[model samples]
Target: MKGVVISMIVVLAMIQFMVKPGQAISCGQVDASLAPCVPYLTGGGNPAPACCDGVKNIKGMAATTADRRAACNCVKDAANRYSNLKDDAAQALPAKCGVQMNIPISKSTNCDVIN
Candidate 1:
């Protein structure tokens, strides 16, 4: 019985791991702050229309003209460096999204500036 219980526990743990956890969006569902692009940020979620709309409303980011250009190039470079469309497309994500990639949010606005 002891062995059986241990096996069952392990099975349960494996099942939980296999299950899709939840939305990958860190800022919550469709919030303006995250631009409804939470999924895109995780490279697994889909960008909500509201998120796209919010992207347009964001104000100035902390970046210089040169830094913006460099950030843009970095986005492209990251895209090429990563595998799969999700990872590559994430290169264009905003500051919030960039944070998920371990890149600083300050670098976020540059991708748009470069494009």
Candidate 2:
């Protein structure tokens, strides 16, 4: 009985460590997923299939509020890195790709307000 109880406690502790809270996405992942979209965003043209795929991937990865906010911040940071990034193109990206994003991909967007 003592051994069984101890094993159960160990399992519970392991489960706690396995389930991390509020860190579903990282900036590196966001950057990788959205990198392909940069060219289209900078220069007006039909977004490539890879760009659209990246957009969709970003939407899918942002499952939780934290993830969404992180993605938003990362996108804003990435956009800032490119001075030529077009606002019109960024605004049109989600609709153009047929992907709905909770957080708009813009440098000016307030990530903290994304819920």
lDDT of 2 by residue, 1-115 (tens): 9788557545644543454555577666666666667779999797888788878877877888888988899889989998999999999999999987787988799999999
Q: Which residue segments of model 1 deviate by more than 4 Å?
A: 1-43, 46-62, 87-92, 95-115
Q: Candidate 1, residues 3-108: lDDT per residue as tens digits?
A: 8855754564454345343322221111223324445655655566655444432222213454334434443453444344364345455543323232323223
TM-score of each: 0.30, 0.78
lDDT of 1: 0.40
Clash pairs detected, candidate 2: none
Among all candidates shown, the one with the greatest lDDT: 2
Model 1 TM-score on a 0 to 1 scale:
0.30
lDDT (C-alpha) at residue 20 in model 1: 49
